[model samples]
Target: QPANKVFPHFVPSLSGFSLTSEVKTQDVEYDVPKANSTDGKDEVLFGAEKGWLGTPIDELNRMPQCAPPLSHLKVVPNHTVTVRTDLLREGEVPVPYPTKFKDAWDDVSVKMPCSEKNLFPMETEDGGGVQSRWELIHTALQGGFKKRSHLTILLLQCLFFPTLSSLQCLELCEAQHLFEVVLPAMVSLALSAPRLCTLPIPLLKSRMNHSLTMSQEQIACLLANAFFCTFPRRNSRKSEYCNYPEINFYRLFEGSSSRKIEKLKTLLCYFRRVSQIRPKGLVTFTRQMVNNPPNWESSQTQLTRLHITCEGTIEDDGYGMLQVDFANRFVGGGVTGHGLVQEEIRFLINPELIVSRLFTEAMEYNECLIITGTEQYSKYSGYAESYKWKESHTDETDDWQRRCTEIVAIDALKFRHFLEQFLPEKMVRELNKAYCGFFRSNTNSKHLSAVATGNWGCGAFGGDTRLKALIQLMAAAEAGRDMAYFTFGDAQLMRDVHEIHTFLTGRKVTVGRLYSLLNQYSSTVCKNCRTTRPDESLYSFIYQKVSSQTATDALKVISDGTDTKNLW
Candidate 1:
């Protein structure tokens, strides 16, 4: 895992908010020939050892088409005492942790310090006077949070104020007997500490490898630390740590809507389970990249055959394979805001992935993220704003001691103007980004599974469905992988994509030809409609051009073995 010199790491900007330069590939180095071609003037060629119009192309033959078996990979979980609690039922209701929660905390508290002063203020000026941690938590829960009722209150206490007495706040607990056994040990741990609960220093550092493996218990601890708002200086906007994504639980407490409360129930339910059970195996957050990204203009790769469907999710469709997340540059994508998309849904399900934000810097266009071994703690059904976290389930681990999951975060460019995305440079930028994310394994090894993605940047980013789909297909082909595209209920997109793909496949169109056509098509459209027009779709244009008898005859004439001299 050596660094590629061609893609040198870019330093963060002064504000520490955005990338200042191009992104560098992490932990991977591979040899690529230098091309002599200048930008825009060089002739583009595919499958040429001499290099595609001076833009060097790595030999695809050496790259593996499929990933190596899990047994061959080593994924070790960080050492932490696991708390077992699998007996809890899953449904609409939130459940408290097992009675063993306090005992587990007591065992760990010996190594960790406790707070000498009160964790919360004794009283609030605007509200009824609260005297203790238990009372404050109780009062917070009393405002008609009826989703899981008593279990919610009890779990909140265990998560935030581990040492708060259940007996002392018996009125808050509608079922006093349920938490009596867990409260004593929990209170002892809370009274012992007011300092921030933090991760081990080594675990928090940003490294070249950019890979971190944590046990379920460790993830629980990190999240619980956030729950208590114990992470020092995290709450302040001006804090040095403000550059990092928000990890504290302050946002959840800001509003009192039922939807917000439901979100809380989902989060606590996960905590309750982790507090009780030590999940087996580990999860790894590894940021990945293409060591020598291909210049898309010169790539001659063919569109790897795709399975286009309007149904299913990326996780479900691409199971046991690498699943792509259309992430924001900062990752997690407004999980703390009102926005909810695939990224948010993925985070809500596999909450551990959210912790990657703690160290992951804002990504550049060429950068993509790879997360392995994240366990899904909850189930959900719905898209975007309607998404609901439903039921609890255990993720089975693979032979390599990793969870049976691999997610790559590939952020699409966000265009303020619709026409901006049609520019050739923008398309090339997207092609590189998608290829970087799709190109799995290294030069010596390959993970050949098809990518599962669809409607990627089309939603919030305002990308053309047909155009983005083609871009993704080209990138996947260049990466030596097929694609399983989930249209996510966009029937027209599914139909258009299928027709275009069918036509292209029938003509045996290489990626280079389509790319050339894309460039031509983009240029033509821009000229045809100076103003942004929705009717002139890339799919319709391609279909008309490729399906024409003249175009077919031209294709037959140009077909001369592997080398089609006339790209136009």
Candidate 2:
């Protein structure tokens, strides 16, 4: 079969690849838009573009509606409400008193680890001393911690010497801080478990659009429970939580690697800060699903604006924009274990994000989790293996409905074979996944913020950066939003991608034309056994075809419509 017949209406002219009169090759002047100033004036920094700090987050879309109203308590069937509700009722009228506490470890609530009924006696090394878990927690709650208290000894035994034979991992200072500062705050937070979780948190199921909203105090309480290894049935793969990410802190504490120690420092720092002053604002976790996926080969959406840069990170420079979390299918990935990649690092900095793993099931291809209002607490330097925890970060960002940040977790396909991604179906899957994360409702279209993302699924997942970047751009365009792409210090990639974006936008290319071109490119790459050569790269192919072809040729591909047989 002819190449054009396999991918109809997408064959480049036989005149070969050359920049024609229609395609301008001169240096395109990219726009550097100013951020909205704090003092009611537009402020343009020295090298500012679309996603600077001064841009007010409040001016963007309104906060998503929270479920179960903050004032009332509603416990749905099958879901577990951890907090005691009887203490919250006032003369038959349901009222919310989040601080009111009473223990209820029934069949319909979270099994409180600190409850006296759940604790068991453990013998001491002296061959006589015995203490229950409740007594240890009670002693810590009462501020009776000493240098070598039983509670501290037990914690060290559980964390560092889980096998009772490994070398002690914590240094003197780290151990002291863990006992004196972190443990007390953690115990104090854990004590509020009965009051914090007032309603049965709905599980963010695989294919549902559900949102869970709670105050920072509530999240702190849950995290405290997780730190104590309190959440039941979460430790093993054979348990009911097999479909969910691990929520216990044991895996993080079990290892003795320098990486694990550094991660522990970051986590300890969060406890210290939250212990001093509990956050009052609200955070929401939303599971968004798309029932009707986009028609990638037929839709005619134009490319939105883009700010491509080689400097800064998604968390730092991409503030005020909807930031993307290069996540694992099981949300938090290996933050619980030793795995610290982009998603795990993000969760570590903002520990509140880890709570999502408790309820969020393994993600599907057409679903993404959007977390709003999480405040970053710790600043760190370096990537995995060389990771170090810097000093605490005081988040000064303004809040939108008591929320300071917006993050979307989108998991990409992890390929065992490098050539697997070259399949048309794989490309379409990625495109749909990105689209699901980026799409906003028509009502919020006017306030749709530019997506802040970079090299998603390009590292250990074996994805080509060029292909992933273009896929995100297409998705953002179809979703009617601009983008701020951080290349993570890849200057060549920044320039190359910016050049292609400039060329495509200058020629007024629609998404449909690009999708058809991608389909044709995938078919070509799959037929060849080897990976994409420099001359045969996606960017090179696009540049050659798009620059050489006329506007009419590109339009004809879209006008002819997508072949449904090939549409995945």
Q: Which is the leading candidate under lDDT?
A: 2
Candidate closest to the true structure, highest TM-score:
2
Tell me the lDDT of candidate 1.
0.56
The TM-score, computed over Cα atoms with residue i paired to residue i, of candidate 1 is 0.66
Q: 1-568, model 1: which lDDT tens digit per residue?
A: 0111110111111131111233343232212222222222333332222211121212121112244544333323432212222322222111222222232122112112222222444446776543444344434433332333444455455344322121122232322322332222223223322221332222232223355555554555556555544444455679655445666655655544434443553554465455455555556676654557776666676666566655567776567666888898878876654556788778877888877765566676667778877877666655564555555667665543457787889888888878888889998888888988877555322456667787878767988788899999888888877677777755556556755775676566778877877887778886567676646777777767766844667677767444444433
What is the clash count of model 2?
0
- lDDT per residue (tens digit) for residues 304-342 in model 2: 767777667889877767899999989989998888878
| Alpha-carbon TM-score of each model against the true structure | 0.66, 0.75
Q: Where is the poorest 10-residue window by lDDT in model 1?
A: 1-10
lDDT (C-alpha, whole model) for all candidates: 0.56, 0.68
- Candidate 1 positional error at 26, Å: 47
Please report how far candidate 2 places residue 7 from its true position, in Å.
Answer: 60
Q: Give the Cα error of residue 92 in candidate 2, in Å.
A: 26
